[model samples]
Target chain A: MSAERQGAASAAPDPRISMRGIVKRFGSVEALRGVDLDLHAGECLGLVGDNAAGKSTLTKILSGAYVPDGGEIRVNGRRVDFRNPADARVHRIEMVYQDLSLCDTIDVAGNLFLGREPMRGAFLDRRAMRDGARAMLDRLEIKIPRLDALVAQLSGGQRQAIAICRAAAFDPEVLIMDEPTSALAVAEVEAVLALINRVKASGVSVVLITHRLQDLFRVCDRIAVMYEGVKVAERRTAETDLQDLVSLIVGEKHVSKAAGAAAGPGGAA
Target chain B: MTAYTSRPAGSRLADMLATHAQLLSIAGFFLIMVVIFSVMSPVFLTTGNLLNVLRQAAPILIVAVAMTFVITTGGIDLSVGSTVALINALAAILIQFGIPWQAVVPALLLIGSAVGAAQGWFIAYQGIQPFIVTLAGLSALRGIALLMTEGFSVPIPGGIGFVQIGRGWFAGVPAPAWIAVVAAVAGFLALTGMRFGRYVTAIGANQEAARRAGIPTRRILLSVYVLTGLASAVAGIVIAARLGSGSSNAAVGLELDVIAAVVLGGTSLMGGRGSILGTILGALTIAVIGNGLILAHVSPFFTQIVAGAIILLAVWLNARVFSRLAAGTRRRT
Candidate 1:
């Protein structure tokens, strides 16, 4: 895999996107406190934190949903400013919001196309849209029964799948997802995890935020733990176990038993 | 997973029926109304009276077409009747000033767009609720009309081409009826076939989602009100032409009738779902009932009661019966 080749070639690979000293505040409450993050191409970075830990805020800044009060963002080493979500989209950044962002009354194909509908001389090219939507779903191996069904009629998993498909279909350079599997059934979660792997394999950088700690081990190459709006620690998947990550996430000064016993002196690092 | 397989081909008919249950039921109700009216009044079934009904229904039908778009966006344009009255009075005043009807018509339509755009600005940009904004417009606009006309009817001069819009016939149909037909057809095509219609539904379905998806939602919202404004102007012109006069009191309750027609046609006031065909049928049904009642020698006062009752009954059947049928079929499948 290209990702494997890159990992072996350098101790610190070049980042596709880099954020430095990102700061966000709501009135007197600071949501993010000068955070720095780097996402390499073709790698899934897991961002884990408890409630109000600023994980959502950081990702929203990257996705251009929120403007940081102080920050420098560089995409492929070139500095950029994102005034709005549309600006982020121009740089090929797409986000699957926590709410899935699917319109319930719109049909599957309609939701898939959403804001940018295919048109022929001012009229919606519905036939082409349906055909394109089918191809997109098929490419993602999403087993939706009907493309014409209203999104509200779909199961939670199916709706999630549609939302992911819409974001993925745009060929984004960086895809950010917030709590994607939070409300999914076990089987649906498996489907989404598999989908994440498929997206990563296609050479897109992915930033995933999830409370499901176990999920980070499955798809993430690296994990960043946040506490109280600060990036407390970062670890490569090969170097860190779940207990050590959990300790970092919950802000424990002492390492957990499994981690302490397994790594000895390395546990402190 | 196997349970999620494509629906059996044999059930396609059932599926179509279930999906379109609301539209089908409204159509059926409209036909039943026609039969009942035809039986109760001999004149109701005649070509002359039918044309007259269409002529009278023209204003409601035209405005209702635009209202469908507004409602589809989950918004209501309560100021439409006031817009119509203002345009009606304004058109008469212009005609009386010896301005050409040709110049007056287009100018009124532009004024309508300006009025709609102004309200849309408040609703979409200023974050005012559509109901409150349009309600304000409804009051303010009518008051402006009253002020302009000094609470009196402004008479239009006869023997002018302006009167032809209301009085003339085209290809064996009233001109106003023809205008309504064109409006209905355009509404149907725009809603079903055009990108604008898709955005309208999307905005109504979920404004945030639509905005995040890169749709210019606020502009689209603004445009729908503009559409209603333009439509109300056309309706006003037709009314002034038909009566040979314009009054501030004209079409006082027209908004309610237009909204009733749209809702009766199964276009949800909650938005994101609409059918232009249903609106047409709804408008015609209202017209037919009113005309038939008059012909049957029923008091005009009772007409409102019957119309309201029928609307309630039709909507009830739509929500209750059709939903149950759909649910039962889903369980069976």
Candidate 2:
């Protein structure tokens, strides 16, 4: 991103993506109510909350997996309506689902280019898929045994890498990753964190949803905390610590802490 | 760093074997069946008997090839036999009405595809179980055929060149076998190389994932059934032409044989894995068992019993012994 885009001191720049009054309901349960968010280019915004705090719902609406019951999403200053994930993809929005959304029977290269495979006349462009998969893995700094390996035989982290590689390879402008590191081992988490940073450096706006509070400080430029179905607080990562974030997430006396600097005990960043 | 650090990678050969353990086991078993049958019956090794076997296996091979696509998507079409009977009777009735053979063939194929499409819509779009939908098809379709033909065999006039489809030869190979070979090759190309085949496998593997990836999964699922229907029509035409008559009772247990052939070839009933080559071997294996048994003087009724036993044995070995063998070989290497 340009230098002006990174400065948040004054003269706020236009957000890469903006959402206003997002609301979603599953019958009697209100999943999200009147939630608004702004994401800038080349930044990772951490979304943290309890289970059903509307984090995943908000992200799902953003990724076009679910249409908000009422909301306006503006991307690059233009309002767009998405009816499905395919529509979101047209505007370069992508999400790595928590389930990983991968075909275990297909090879790595095939999974990377599932619906949009490169075809040569009547057949798949196998050579292109192989070389393209190699290039994407190289760019993301992810390694696996072979491009032709079936996903079922790969380790969990490798499978996660494949899922991440698929979303990142598509040059998405707004990438949402829901708990990418939830099931990974420790070393694998480090690798995924490194990969997230790599993706962010390429000037893509990223939304990361995770319960690992410690991970927020390491990768997020700003943290957004949710309580119930409402976004209760937003904090610049430099100005907040784990205690404050925890308090914000749990909605515990948020008003008193609101006035303080919230520079409590340092977190495990 | 590599994404996974748990273990060293195995040799490519070992990996390949493990990946294709089912195919390898079925292939080896097929070869073993051929050898045993040849030894058991002196006539089995001859060119004439093998061609006769090919002719007998042609209908099963053609339908089994299509069933491989259906099974690969984790769906079963139990109505294939009924489909054939319906198409067979309908063609005879249409021919008896003095229609051209050329027009009737294409017309029957379209009807077959329509029948399959109807079933597919319920299973794919309506979200019904394939087993239930096709089981209903099995009963309803044959009932229609029986009502149309009134439980009687309808005969076609001789020497209209239609019977050539079932009995005629080109380059000394049986015409039905040639048509089967064509179907197999086309199905093979579509399943292994084309985007259609990839999407079919993907749908079977993880349907939600495939859908989220933007694959037209329901359309693909629907199309596989259409393939089975079209293949059944071809089988029906071949049968009607060969016998000079159409019977509702024709191919009574054919669904069992086709399903047996597909499953025996190692296509999973649970979906996501398929092999056209395997289905060909599997159908041929079943045909040889039937032909070889009769030549060995076993009662005709025993063929069903023996074929059932073999299917059970082959699948058991593929899942248990051969899979372990594949893993063990990998570890040893």
Candidate 3:
């Protein structure tokens, strides 16, 4: 909450990432069509939409999982093209995939340091890795009793947390998470929202995609609603309640006036 | 807020046990086999007989170590036996032509790598299923071997230093056994303490995820097959050196034994999990059974039956007993 207040007080903070007219196609289906978004430093942007609304696709493009057929991406006012995930990573952009992207049979420490393991000459520095993992988990306030436990043994929320921590630990200027809390329990969801606040406080821009509309109010400074590959509305969290977002996500014409009004009070909290 | 207390201290011990449940079960089975064989046959525990068993089991052990890496990556090299046969025949042909054994040794290894790289190209870069590709290699490679040797055994002349590689002893252990030991130790170190092993495990667990994590997954996949090919070449050379002759018919059906040994060692055929120590025990167990049956005056054919039954039972124990134990402990906590 303090981070959001500070972000608002700043005078027109420069966007850490800017995407203009981003377009992507998947053989005949246009997954993303002419979408524009700007993510400022120290802000969380909540992306919400119904199924097939292009939320995942857009974020994937941003994270370099998909190549945009048309449009430009700017990081810190410099135009850049990401040919692959590695390219985005060079610019300190990280993403927690919807699938989690964790090797189930690998230990928690191993998963966190998957491709870029700490090595001593030709061998993996396992002791250093375990120690680094312990420190990383502690810094995130994530509690898992054993670092060597295989990811398959961990619960869904713990796995999600590990994935998020993996991305966040990279000291990314921008972090994108797709449906991070969709499968989490109530306490886990709260923990994730709190983690987002912490990240924002450190001046990292976060793009969060979720179906849970109410979660945006908890951590997001701004919300962007998408419908069928197009961004329909962008609202400041303090200015617009969840009712506006719900209508915006559903596309205004689809919702009756009664439902919009009915949703108002519940959406405010 | 639930403070997320660490599971009780006892569970730490339980966790360690559960993680190694497959290995421990296999080890127990290996010990039981050793005991049963020792009791049934008086000569089974003799040092000379044991040395012979070690010498004979060396080739299979070496290749099984490589296959552990392959299987851990969710791939199989069915062509390994055929590769061994090809190298076996090729080495004899070269030695018959008066090529020095030292030169031929490295040459055969390179040939093995080339063959593996070719197959790996198809499986890795060409997007073919490893099973289908290696199955094709099994037939083609054996065919090549038969054609080269003309269905005849080629004799390696005596008094050559090449024989020492297979028959000589080092510190009272057979050369081949020493070689197998070296390969196993190297494999253990690489798989347990290296990044390559981690990537292989990751690739097996989830290929796309590994790729997204910036790992060159296809290269790693291709390299594992190369290891198998190289190991097969070593095995082929040892077989030729020991017998002082090479034939295309050598090592026929050997792939099955190697696969069985690896699986019996608790490495999952589905991939993402493996153990070199288990593979070592598994290979020795199979070797012991074959040797023990001959010493016990049992029918040679029954050895196969016993070995097959034991493999099936060990795998069942791993999948059923160990998993259930792990699950039961989880439920209690």
Candidate 4:
């Protein structure tokens, strides 16, 4: 654990969102143990950890997909309890899940405005959805060839782009993304990374969870490393390099320079 | 960019054809059958015979329209036939017992909706397999109808206005056919143009995804079965009115005919894909086969044989050939 973590967070005095002592358990398996996280508005915080490190569980709790056994979340310093995803959504918190959570048979515009569709009287407003989806994609600088085509017909990067754009469309105060680029080709990954930065520029606090160590350097202002079910360390991206994050993620004692080099080079592997 | 993006890199015409290839395949089959029947029986294409065909096809079309909703959600209501029979027998017995025909219609429609709601509750809320739940209904509903009538056909008086729903004609078309048209148009609107249709497609395409997106998946799923139940009631009423009697034996195996029409029209059992237009065409095709075969001087038994064969062949080709083609298109795109 680094002593600098506390002050090394964003220079912003008031964090837009904060979670403290967020403990969750799946029966006897404790998935999250007293985790604390913070996000400043208009900045991306990267949550990095290995499998079963409870990164997903922690994010799911924040997104109201799961309830924490013990914890409190604050938005603008106001305490909030979210019983469901809808509750979290009311607070302008949104998440793009790891599975993508997209219907392959639906069109791009349909998937983008899924839960809250544009309706004119009794039917869907197709022209509105089409024009709106185009503007949404353009705002994020992602290009999807056809808005009417089924999502199954899109490239991996384009699908990921749609998911990100969908979450961003929530006009969220805090946006959480889980491995948004884990399934993309190289070019596509860059496109998504660029999307995240653009989204961050719009004053939305972003939580990004990814295993790709170098990606943290590109878009993240700060990196939080979790070991097992606990947050072992947090670092300002400028102060820490790949070696320190690699060591911290695997439990600082066993991280060798050789091991860090192998997992280095900023590729997903 | 607009020109390039408006049309994908693939040939737009080819894409359109490929996208609706299932619909076109069924349409082509329907047209060929019509031509063959017209050639064999000059009466097949005549106005009177066509009107008769529409009248006969009406009940099946009404129920199949609702079944489209059920199938689109990746479910089967095997009890639809029994539902029709139960309503048919129950309506007749009520009329015989001195209840006004007017009072019985809406009451039976409610009963039909209740039957569907029960099955849907079990499937959506209790986590029961839809097949098992509806299969139980298939057995139990028909049995209840048999008990109500004691295995005899109940006579419905020929003079009631209720009979108009089956035998009367308006604008030179049978009343039943008009009712069927309303059901089909409403169904087409719900499946193609409404938010209900979009959510139905999303739920079928990926239920968990739909749920996470804040769609009320369970409610949508349950409501689909209810639609089937309500449609089945209308069909039963139409059938009883036409025959002037009702029996527990009515519409026996009718579920197969409706399902065959739906599948033949290219609604995939896999649940995500549905086509109401394709369903109307498919039902009409089946009606023609039955009506045309008799006119062609073929044995009536062969009509059943052909309908059953067409069901098996359509499903086989879809599973083996069409799915492969769809996958190929998806891969290329």
Candidate 5:
């Protein structure tokens, strides 16, 4: 946020979030092997790869939904361990999952403040919640018919907005979006893209995991390519071509065995 | 191109009707029932008969209110009937045991909540299917109730106050009706106004999403079931007081009526939607149907058939209304 912090962020390679030698296994399948990643503050880092590239596994580990067998996660240059998603939230790490977790029976305000609701006296302060929800929606430039409307009645994009609003309201230092735009239409996707831009501008580090290269080019400042389980390459969005990135993901270009062993693209480490 | 756009408007109107068509259809059916009953018996329109219906509906209303919470979270409790029976039997037994009514009542309420929480723990944290877990509880609780009563009725303490709490009229209405109204209001507040209420709805809506959002989901689930159990216990106590006796067989087959009320009230059995007000209406509606049948001199066995039909009709109408509302909203999208 300060100039010195910004200078340190650009000068030193200390990422806002850093994962080194992360390994995760589900049963016999090693989903991720020795994967390493660096995410700088206020940067939109795109994670691009094929379906089995372990993007979700990496996301899960980073979000504290899953613990990796071997890895050190350093947040804001400080080494930390997260036991659960709640712990991750405390460390200013939040995720907007593709499913857009929400309660459809309640109104938008109730959904936005699902876990952490404002309270006055013994009551839930529904009025304050509604007003605060409206403010958050406005801040994110989200348009909905009414704050009191039940989420079940919302369009896909509007539901997505509620999820984004919740994460943003918490003001998490790292926001991971797992294909946030996948379920949306064109206009809705644009709306989400605008929100991403606003989040990035506000200096919250973003990790956008998507197979949509066009989305990566539109919003990501830097792109990280993951081939199989390992992060194979990191390229500035302006410097890297999509073809080169695709090549890196498919392991077409020559890569070090350490990286290859890390990737396990051949299904063996 | 114009027709494509223009036709949607007609379709939109049609969809709106389709979505809410069930509500209209149900309302029509309700009207038809009322007319038929009125024609069949002049006594159906009397205030005394209406009050009698409400008084009889009170216990089911209390249990159904709690059931709405459980069902909204996509769960069910077959144990409520057993729970009510146990409480009824206990209230009378405790009174006979020389336990003061003041302490006896609170103890029963706490015991009810504990039973509910016990069941909830198995469902919420253990990841057990609610139907299986509650069905086990349904049978288990009845066994416990029978054991407590030794398969016999326990006589009340023969106190005027205890009977007054159950059967006495405060202002031309039975005390049970008033207790039910109070409980329903309290249930409504706990669900819609408090943090716990919101969490329950959230869990019902999407448990996985709520978990990701850092909600204490399992705890909330446990608490909802406990609340339901406590409500059923209260219903049981009232039944004991009203009868001046507690029987192991008390509240037998009451689950069907409670569930009927819940479905009629428009709470989705599938999870993630419910209304306390609707459930109350449902309770009253079921009560009215039963009362009308009894007044019309229909066989008691036929009452069960009528209740089943009403429940089926309510659910059908609810689905119809739900689809129409969904279509209405979808058209806008």
Candidate 6:
């Protein structure tokens, strides 16, 4: 997964969530090999890697979007297992994928709850849902005129905000976002970065997976890099340079020794 | 900004016009025909003729209601026509074997639902293309109907229970017309008020998203198909009652008419955007067009050609109106 997920490995730094020895395979391709990860309270962990570097696979496992082949997961130092996204939701874990997973034809309220729509009698309680959706949007400072306006009518940034609002409305303890701003315009990307900061300030731990190094340096408190299926290095934003991170991600053996030696002190990446 | 963001006055008028465009256009067409027919013939606008039109529209409306569901799911059941034929054949065979009409009603309904479920399972679970499965069904079910009836019509016996279902009436309205009203109301309720309706729309909008959202996509798909079958069976019974007989050839080529009504009513063939109100309007439009054509003394062959052309035109217009509505705004960055 992302290097930011790896931290103070052997010392056990009071992690809110941790995964140990996670192994996953898709046919003959080993996507993850004995991976370890941890997330602390209210910390934004920025995970970076090249294409097919297992960043997505790890996020999927943590969010209960996929089942890991072998691993034990711990929440607040207590062991737990998740069989589905709903199961993870019980533990206050939610994921907002890059696609946003919002139904384009439905309005914000409908997309917010989706399959979990609130109903009164035989019909959907549109007023109640709309009110709740509006409240969530207001808190996020994203204004759309009508709760009934379809997502297809919204801008890319606005849709991303709605998605984060949805995950936040559910009151998840940990929120994972996959490449939240990869396809956005410059302004839209800035809006999403601001939303991420707002989400972190609200005391919800955020795991951001992205390939954009600039975004990592901009918003991430801790940076993690993954090479192939293994996390190569993890460093605090203050301690690591972009070139060293790039060297680890590209699997250059010349700098691997120095990078590995520094990361090993804290058993990170 | 509000004024600019809002629909134009002309577009607002257009929106209202477009909302009931199918009905308005169909009525306009009917009025022109009525004016011509009244000029040419004395008995063109008689009550008897109007009632006759109602009777003709009954079976088509029933079949079209089922088509509404199929089309709403971004799928079509080419087998509905065949299912109607099969139902008719089965009803006749059972009646001939001394089975009570009450029992036969349930049997036909069950058979219809089962056939629909089979098609739906293939579409939803097996990932088979709807066109192929229903097209295969169109052939298979008709063959079954032919096999059972041996390609012959079966005469209705006297004093059959629920024969009144086809021929009976409440107050002054025909029983079939009342049944059509009830079916339409039920369909409207199911589409707008129930959980099933929501799931159907979700599946139509994006099956993958709906599935990931934990919708019972497979089950709902099965139900939609089975519902269509049930509708077909109901139409079959009404047809059999109206004719006082059943034949393997009953409801032949009816699928095209039902689909035409659905598309004309503004139900997107692409799914995720259909309404019972629209379907009702669409079905009425088709009935009016067909009735008006005959009243105007048009040749039956020309009527068929004109009807097909009108359906295509209505759908094309519906697409333009909707796309305009969907593309109403541009961001002001």
TM-score of each: 0.93, 0.93, 0.93, 0.92, 0.87, 0.85
lDDT string, candidate 5, B130-197, tens digits: 88988898898888889999999889966558877788898888999999999899888877787777
lDDT comparison, 1 vs 6, better candidate: 1
Give the local distance difference test score of model 6. Answer: 0.76
Tell me the TM-score of candidate 5's A chain: 0.87
Q: Which regions in candidate 1 have their CA more than 4 angstroms from the true location?
A: A1-14, A253-269, B1-10, B326-333
Interface RMSD of 5: 7.3
lDDT of 2 at B272: 90
Tens-place lDDT per residue, model 4, B1-333, is 111122246666666766787787778778888999999998899999999999999989999999988898888889999999999999899999999999999999999999999999999899798899999999999999999999999999998898898999999999999999999999999998998988888888888878777788889999999999999999999999999999999999889889889988888787877899989998998888888888998887687888678667766765567646644554531
lDDT of 2 at A233: 83
Mind sharing the TM-score for model 3?
Answer: 0.93
Here the TM-score of candidate 2's chain B is 0.96
Which run of 10 residues does model 4 chain B get worst, by summed lDDT? B1-10
Winner of 3 and 6 under TM-score: 3
User: Please, what is the whole-model Cα lDDT of each candidate in the order they appear?
Assistant: 0.87, 0.87, 0.87, 0.86, 0.79, 0.76
* Model 6 CA lDDT for position B277: 71
**Candidate 4 displacement at residue B275 in angstroms:** 1.0
- Candidate 4's error at B239, in angstroms? 1.2
Better of 1 and 2 by DockQ: 2
Model 4 has an lDDT value of: 0.86
Report per-candidate DockQ.
Answer: 0.39, 0.47, 0.47, 0.46, 0.37, 0.27
Selected candidate, larger TM-score, 2 vs 5: 2
lDDT of 3 by residue, B146-258 (tens): 99999999999989999999889999999999999999999999999898989999998998888878888889999999999999999999999999999999999889989
Identify the runs in model 3 with alpha carbons over 4 angstroms from their true place: A1-14, A257-269, B2-10, B322-327, B330-333
